[model samples]
Target: MTWEEIAKAKKASVDDAIPSEWRLEKNPTANKVRNVGEYLDETLPARENSITSCTVTELAGKISRGELSAIEVTKAFCHRAALTHQLTTCCSEIFFERAYKKAEELDEYFKKNGKTVGPLHGVPISLKDQVNLEGIDSAIGYVSLVNKPKNKDEVSNIAKILENAGAVFYVKTTTPMAMMSGCTSSNIYGYTYNSYNRLLSSGGSSGGEGALIGARGSPLGFGTDIGGSIREPSCFHGLYGLRGCSNRLPYCNVTNSFAHAPVLASVIGPMAWDLDDLKLVTKLIIDSEPWMDDPKVPPIPWREVTDYPKKLCFAFVSDDGAARPHPPIERALQMCKDALVAQGHEVIDWEPPVSFIECRDLGASIYGADGYKEIADECAKSGEPIVREVMVLAGNGTDLPIGCSHVHEHWEQNKLRYEYQQKVDKYWKSTAQQTSTGRPVDAIITPLWETCSFKCEDIDMFSSAYSSTFNILDYAAVTTPVTTADKTLDSKDETYTPISDHDRAIHEYYDPELFHGTPVGLQVVTPRYEEERAIYLSGKLRDALSERR
Candidate 1:
């Protein structure tokens, strides 16, 4: 069928599936648009200029001291998120009514008990679309998945923990179709944009969460990362995002693709505006003992580690040795190096031997190993048009199903990945020889991707090797925004030469002028299951950069 025919059929199917109770009787209120500055001005008092600038720790302290009520704090965030979603299309579902009700409950609890409800009491949290809420749709950008009632109770372990701890759920965010690519777009939501610059993408499949937090719409949110889904968007929007070790947080009841396929290195974790908030959310979830409910989760408790030495070491890589980063990304790396050195930390050039190409190719094979026949079957059930990126994964219309032999070949690849992990561990251990403190680097700093952020059609050209390489190695990676895209300084180099058509096309997407003020992010990577260490190191890096400024 033609594209037009497909579009009409999909619309009709969606209309037919809408619940009778939810069918609109009248037009809904038109969404409002506002920038970050305008939003802060309207919601906060004259003396509260810093309200928009403060971290979650500061906000929590104020609430605890009775200077702010839960309802007031929650309202500020919900209003801001509504505006952000209007401008950037960051939300897949909005629950302002429910959030307000929860906020009121939190306020009553504090008043009666004379204490805070929990560590994150009154804080508004956003979630990626895949997380299950009792009544909310867990539609991860597939029209077919929309409005489908859960077979059982949809109270995800993570959601239960957050609710018990006093978090007010204001919104559930969007993702790309099947969340298969790094750009956020789907037939259901169209596209999500960077709040900082409307022309650029927010990054995906956690793009909506990234945009929401970056715009200060919510203080904290959760996103999942398979191939830089969390880290890339976090970097693109200038926020703090963590791709924790798989199973560190509960994943049970969360909707995902290829449910029958053996798990790979994908993980779910928090995204926030500041490092301290990231720590706050991480501690709460891990302390909640998610393993009790989700069999897949490991029984690991959050550990409080002491601070490292004053002088620390870092291994820096501007690129994954696959493709060079754009000018803005290059500048962000330099700024980080300079900031660290100025703070009395040791910085050294890193040249790891692993090939990012191999890492990315293998990861893609794992993702498409089923040849997406299952995904196509699901799409057909609802008669929703397959998204463009999903088409890419289906591989040039072949759509051929992979047999048992292909599955066995993937098992062989998994063994090779295990071998690769050992080599990386050895390489990290050897870094001690080059450090003045005689200890290996605390973390490796690398770009999240080769570009700041891309437009929709341009996303296919860029490889997610920078972040995906860490996933393949099963290392913990944290994304921290360093600077904004500066068009004058970030222009494409005229002297640049292409390694291939893909390389050149990727380079051509860098319109620094269009991407100006967009967040340029860096990744901090540590060994697997080292979330505490990762969080601590991320805090140190945030402090180091703040001190420099």
Candidate 2:
């Protein structure tokens, strides 16, 4: 079969898997509905609406107390998730029957034992397409990988940990081909629209997870980040996403593009609607001692950080110098600074000795070290063109990248990465002299992207300067949603001059009308292996922002 034929059959199969009653009567086109999240909330039956709206913690608590059954929670999420997929194309795999079976078992266990199986008993959790599951395809948006399903031996370690905690999985979300784009789109699943605003791109490669959770199809889900996959989508949807340091959470058995790329490693983490829920899942996985099963993971126990200082200092980066953030982002940053200051915390301008431009360029070279050969080879198996959004990885979306010709050249790039890390680490330590608390800044707050989100096809127009720099530094970071784009409050700058050609393109791309109502968020950064501290600061910031409002 042609690639198109294979893609059609795969899509059909997913649609068929959804029970007929759960499917939407008509899928709304972009012109008809711009916010599928609000659409679903208004249309779903009251019981399903309330069930899906509950947080991970809330659902788990109710189930443990027997106020809600595992089967009912699973059924509600399945119905809502099926409708979400129909509207946004967010799901890559749909297996409601399997989820129901799991839920039934959990319910039965509770009835017989007089107690819940685990903390997450009966709660529905979604997975990105990259997470392996038995009898399901990880596919990661390659049509060539569609028919081939995973076996029992191939289940991801993280999935196993969650299942042990009594989590139920119903669907796996979509991604760009080979999980290689900033926006999710592939020949197999097409563009996964933003649940908040369907006309905009749902940031990728975790884009589908963003769309699903943003639409409240699932309370919480897992997404992997090589550069900014987890953070960008989280920012776009007003969700909290953790991009933990490398192997802080297990990636064992997870399908990925560069499974063994040694120069720069990708990390898997959680994205959730509530700050406490994000913390709960992170600690739960860490508490499982994942290192015993996945040697790559560090054996760091979940450190509870309850004794933090009352007055914390934060470093704020207003611009990355490569591309100036759009108006909404500028306003959001100011709002954060003001909120923290009002809470008696110190917020200072950050001037790192190293440049984000240097870090980002080095990351690009490392990511393309193999010239994206794996992506090309996989596409060749079924003959699907690389999705247009990912063409920037290759030359201008047309020519393939010129890879390093020798192992030594790759080593030089890795060497440069280490040097960058050291310089930034030193600079961060040097900040002790600048703060009133006589310590390094607790965390650095900055924009995740220059804009809240862009039109689906315009992803290539923006640079990954803000988020990818942290990835290269190997720092633990989390995204915190601040506010939304308001046309009246965030007008385009008429007097600002362009700094560079790329900056000019980004500056010219802004239209207050086009981006209104989209979510805006900033990332909180801490040193390497500091996921706990990063998440703590993020929650504090969320509190400050809420109190200010």
Candidate 3:
């Protein structure tokens, strides 16, 4: 078949998977749907909506005790997710019938044994399309990869672990072409819009998972990150996302942009609607002991750290020296600071010892080491043209891979990264001098992005200094939503001065009305490989903010 025929056939197969009753009378366009959750509330039965709103921990308890059957919970989510996909274009693959059958099998097992198979038994889990599943195509937004499915032997370790823990895989979400853009769109599956607003982007490359979770279609989802792939979307959609250190999670057999690019390794992590749900899935995955099968995974069991100081010392930065955040983001940071102080925690000002811009540039060089050549080769395999979103991020506004030809340069880059890490570690230790508790700052809070949301493909490619810096440092970080953009209170300030040309452009584009109601979030970061600390502080911040309500 010609490349065009292959693209059409691939899309047709996904379309065929949808049930006829779920099809909309009119196809949704860019400005058609505003709030997908609201749409489902008005259209779906009240019982189904209530089931969808239950948290993962709550659903697990009810399902395990037999008060609620797995079949009932899975059926409600499948129904709600169907309508969510129709309105948001968030799904790349769907199989609700098979999922219901799987859920029924779980119910039968519980009835026979009087116990659950695992903690997540009967729970439906969504995954990014890059995860290799047996007999399912993991196209990852590339037309050339649409028809080739992985064999059973080649499935990812994460999928197998989740399956044993009783997770029923029913759907895979959309991604941008080559997973290279900050917004979701591709030649294969088109575009995925934000769940709350049609005019705004659902931040990528894990954006499809974000949109699905934001719409309450998936209680727990998995997404991979090399840069801000996991964190950005979670912040944009008001969810919890953890970007763990490299080699911490099971990441084998997953499709990625580069085959063996070695500078900055990608990490696989989870996204959830709430902090408890996030910690629940994270602990379960670690408790499975993935290191036994995958060599890349560290042999670390789940460890609980229960020693947070009663009077903790905290530090935060609302604006990175590079760019001024939009008003909503600034307000979110202030809310976090005020809440932390009110809870008997002392807050201080902090600027990292390392330069975010320099580290981010090194990260980009690592990503582009082989650059567009790989993406071009994949596109050539099917003669599919790269989408505008991918092209706009391709440095010079075209589809050309960068040339990183110096091996010695890469070696030197690694050395410089280590130096930066050491300097930052020293600075963190010195913080005890200023703290009344005489303990180093527990965690640093910062803005997740320069803006709450952006129009598709209109964002600056180099705007990742705030989020990607943590990736470069390999520090563990988790994002949690604080507030939403309010047009009345988060209005524009005309007295701001531009920090740079890029900052000037971003500042000039601010419109309070356009971004009103968009979610604003911040990240709590700990040193490398301290995911336990990250989780503890994130929950603390969540509790502090909850008290304000």
Against the reference, the lDDT scores of all candidates come to 0.77, 0.91, 0.85
The best candidate by TM-score is 2
Q: Candidate 2 on 1-549: residue-level lDDT in tens?
A: 999999999999998999987777777787788888788888888998988889999999999998999999999988888888888899999999999999999999999999987889999999999899999998998989998999999999999999999999999999988887898999987899898888899999899999999999999999999889999999999999999999999999999998998989889999997989999999999999999999999899999988899999999999989778999999999999999999999988889878888888888888888888888788889998877877775558776774544788899998998999999999999999999999999999999988899888887787768888998999999999999999999999999998999989999989998888899999999999989999999999999999998
Winner by TM-score between candidate 3 and candidate 1: 3
TM-score of each: 0.90, 0.99, 0.97
Give the alpha carbon lDDT tens digit for every residue of 1-549 in model 1.
Answer: 543454345435434433344333542222232134354456545544455455778778888888888888876776667666666778888777788898898889899999988877887788998888876778787766676645547767788788788788888888988887788888777788777666678889899998888888777889998889999889987888988887898878778876546637568898987887888888888888888888888998998868668888989986666676888989988888888899889999776666777787777777777667767777776676677766665455334354433767878878878777788888888899999999988889998888888777766566668877888888888888788878887778989997867677767767866777778889888888898888888777878788878
- Mind giving the per-residue lDDT tens digits that candidate 3 earns over 436-490? 8998898889887888878875754446677778888898999988998999998
Q: List the residue pairs that clash in candidate 2.
A: 391-397
* Model 3 misplaced stretches (Cα beyond 4 Å): 28-32
In model 3, the worst 10-residue window by lDDT is 396-405
Q: Provide the RMSD of all predictions against the true structure, rounded to 1 decimal.
A: 4.5, 1.0, 1.6
User: Model 3 clash pairs?
Assistant: 372-401
Q: What are the runs in model 2 whose C-alpha is more than 4 Å off? A: 402-404
